[model samples]
Target: MKLRQKILLLAVAPLAVAMLGIALAVRFQATQLAQHERALVEAAYLQSKETELRHYVELAQSAIAPLVRSGRTDAATRQAAMEALARLDYGPDGYFFLYDLHGRNLMHPRQPELVGQDLWTLRDPQGALTIQQLIAAAKGGGGAVRYLWRKPSSQQLAPKLGYVVAVPEWGWMVGTGIYLDDVESTLRQLDARAETDIRQTMAWIGVIAGISILLVAASGLALNVSEHREADAKLRQLAQRVVQSQEEERARLSRELHDGISQLLVSVKLVLETATNRLRLAPAEGAAVAPVLGMALNRLDTVFNEVRRVARNLRPALLDDLGLYAALQHLAREMQGGSGLEIAVTQSGTPRELPDEQATALFRIAQEALTNVERHAGARRVVVALAFDADATRLTVRDDGHGFDVARMQEDPQRGIGLRNLRERIAALCGQFDIVSGMGGTQLVASLPLARPAAIAHDPVSAGPSPS
Candidate 1:
């Protein structure tokens, strides 16, 4: 992957994971909390129903209190009590019921047909003995029991909570009950609302995660665009520098030919013309013409030597003939003779052959460093060291001169061209280049890996000279 894509992934992946984990945790906790709330609500509703049922049973007992307290157990008193209870209902589905100790129905206001039936073995859909459970609650000194029963209003079986009390004097079970469909309906609504809220929460988390990832990706894209712009600008600057350098080199060569070799050729031509005139005028003056011709031959020799010097400056033939070592040695000798600087060239490890492109790049780097030292460093002594290792080659140039600011010089486009060229050449070979300058001296080092070829076939700045 490209670096931009990797950066975006690194920034967004973790955030997405964390958001997903948070959503899951919220869903789990919300579900658990909803269940707990539902239990609390159901319990509270059932407790209220139990209390209402107990109150209805008390009211029924009050209606029959006069007969029971008057010590009457006759059939008429029993009939009167049953009639009173039959009339003592609160709502259409609310009523009091009576059962004998043997589970025979005594009085049932809602279902009159059940009043005379023996219902001890009767079971609801859930297999619970409904009448027996009610009688048991009465026999246990008045409490509540839950079971299924037909609701009078709906005429369908629904859950019921019945409260009952025992009347020992008459062998009767007095009870009242409230159907629980309303409580369940309320809880169902609550559960639906809770589910909707959880879904919304999860959706919001997803939206936030998506937005965060998009923001990070946008930032990475912006960074990549900025870097690309900077690279393009530097490339344009490098192209301009290459053109300017070529023009400057051509100008120098033109000046050398015009000022040195051209003058010598003109002097030689004048001497030859004088010798030719003398030979044409007097054949006996041939000895004088020979002396003039000899002078012309001497000037011609100077012109040839100057031409050789210019050609050597353009590209050293010694490099192709004997390799980098001999070329560097010759360069040091020539520079020392001209600049009067103590220049030394040394090598370490066994010599190794290199690709032409790599060798040429290194040679150019060395040449640029020495030129900088001679022209700007004002150094008395210079050392150039070349080392060959198992897998790499290193070149170091040091000069004992008053140093200049490395950063400042590199920042100056006009003054830093030579240093920049040296660095570019090393970079084209995929090598490491380092330069350190201070009041003490300046040291420039370039190290290239032997196993790797040049990243490019040629460097633009150093395209002139290469080993054959």
Candidate 2:
């Protein structure tokens, strides 16, 4: 993948995973929260229903209290209370029921025929012995029981919440009940509302996560664009500089040939013409012409040597003929000859052949460093070292000249291009290059790995005071 795509992937992959995790966590939490809230609301609703049923039952108790308040000590009072309860009624589906101590129906206000019938083993829809449980509650000092029964108005089996009381003055059980389907309906409605709220909350979270992801992706794309533009600008500038340098080199070569080699060739031609004319005019003058021929030969030899020097500067023929080591030694010798500088060469480890591109890169780097030492370093002594190892090769060039600030030069392209080019060539070969410089001297070191044909190896060079 391209760098931009890789960067975007790195940025987005984590965010996507985080969003998914958050979404799942929120959904689970919301469901739990809704369920908890529903339970609380249901309790509150059922409590209110219980309060209403109790109030209604108390009203029924008030109606029968005067007849059976224990102060009335007559069988006639008991008969009057029983008849009154059987006849008394309230709103539709609201009534009191009575059972004797023997688990048999005494009076059912709504269903008159059920009076006096045995009801002990009667079961609700869920297989609970409804009449037996209710009789137990009434006999054991009165309580409530939940069961299913046929609601009077609806004539349908529905859940009922009932309260009961035992009258000790007579063998009677008194109870009142209310249908509970309304409470269940209210609970279902609440559950639906909670689900809707949770879903809405989830949707909003999804939208917010989407927006955040979009923002991050946009920022990454913008950064990638900015970096690409900067790289393109640098490449354009380097291309222009390279074109200009090539033109200047061509011009210099042209001038050298025209001024030196061209002039000598013209001189040789004129001398040959004169010798030819003299030889034809007089055979006796042949010995005198030998001097002219010899002079012409010397001039041609000088021109040939000058051409060779220029060619060597362009591309050393020895580099192709004898490999990188010989070429570097020869360079040091030539530099020392011209500048009167003492140059040292050190060799280490086994000599191994390298691929052509690697050999060329090392030679060029050495050539540039030596040129810098000759033109810019003003040094009295220089050292060149080449090491070959089982895994890699290393080259270092050092000079004992007063050094310049390496940082300042790096920021100035015009001043640093030669070094930049050298560094770039090393990088292309996957090799590392470093330069350390100070008042004492400057050092250039480069290393290359043998295993990876396209990679560079780095060997750190220890720098110390220049040789005395």
Candidate 3:
């Protein structure tokens, strides 16, 4: 994978996990909240049921109070009590019952056959006998019982809330009950909705995770492509340097052959001519040929000196011997001699010695700038300055010449090559180069950081003469 993709994945993976965690937490909290809401609703319904039961119980107690106080066992009063009980209709999943002091059922909304049937033989869902317990409580004062109830014909079960009260005059127990299945049904629906919400949240999280992953991958690919292009550019620059180096080497060799061997041949010719004239003139005639031979010898000496000078200019031995400053001074003097132009060379700040590569680079920049001045500038004076401070070494070459527009020259491939090569040389050393040229003159400035000996030792080739 590309670096961008890797970075994107690194960035997104944590976010995905975080989002998923948040979604789970939210779902859990939502489920809890829904459960709480359902509980509240069920409680409200139960409270309403309790209210209804309380009303019925109060009315039934009031109706039976007068009859029980009259101490009447007459059939008319007993019929009126039964009619009053019938008037209180039982709600769905609800029933009302009355029990005598002996725990025999006097009236029941459901299972009316059990009325007046038995004494204290009923057991609740947990097998706890409840009728005798309620009768004992009734005898003491008034009380209630709440437990699960099951009809004999049905398998369905439900929680039941019941309240019981005693009629002391009649020695009877009255109560009402309500099943809790409807409340439970409401809770189940809430649970279902919670599950649905959790699933939806998880789905959204998955989608975000997928998109984040894709974006990371794309960024990685883009970074990889950018790295490739940078590598290619560096390779091209290296190739150009190799070609330029080869050309410089060839020029140096040509200068050496022409200056050294050719000078020797010319000297030999002068000596031969002197010998020939001496043989022809003998003792007396030799004096006449002496002037011609002297002139020839002088010409040969001139040719030899010119050849050596050209060779030195091609590849200066002084560069390695005396260092960059002296080499530049020598070049400036030579340019002044040949071009008849005033060239000024100046040094400022501290004169600390530089590594060979740095010195060579500065010298070459000076050489190329002067060469441009000699070729293109129709000016009379040129100034070359070299300054060194603690941080960096700076070189500037300026000429008062007939300068061309920099933009127009850069647009042409042939004219632009020299400036481009100068830039590349500076860049390789992690330096900066700038050119400013106008109608009157052109100036080239280059600045390079001073490298320590350790850095120079690592790459002697880069520390060599500037490629231009």
89-167 in candidate 3: lDDT tens per residue?
Answer: 6555455678887788888766768777875878876886778876775566654455676642354666676667787
| Each model's backbone clash number | 0, 3, 4
- Model 2 CA deviation exceeding 4 Å by range: 47-95, 99-107, 110-125, 132-145, 165-173, 336-349, 372-424, 430-447, 451-468
Candidate 3: where is the Cα deviation over 4 Å?
1-216, 219-223, 226-241, 248-304, 307-311, 336-343, 372-383, 398-421, 432-444, 453-468
Candidate 1 local lDDT, 1-468, one digit each (tens): 987788778888888888889999999999999999999989988898888888889888888888888888999999999999888888898888889989999998888889789999999987889888888888889999999999989999988899999888899998888888877788999999999999999899889888888887888889889978866766677888889889989899999999999999999999999988998899898888888988999999999999989987888877666677777888899999998999998878777666677677777887888888999899999999888878788889999999999899887655676777778788877889999999989999999987544443332322222322
lDDT of 1 at 259: 96
Global fold similarity of model 2 (TM-score): 0.78
TM-score of each: 0.73, 0.78, 0.57
User: Scored by CA lDDT, what does every candidate get?
Assistant: 0.85, 0.82, 0.74
- For model 3, name the residue pairs that clash: 4-219, 4-220, 5-220, 357-463
* RMSD (Å) per prediction: 5.7, 5.7, 8.2
Q: On a 0 to 100 scale, what is the lDDT of residue 428 in model 2?
A: 80
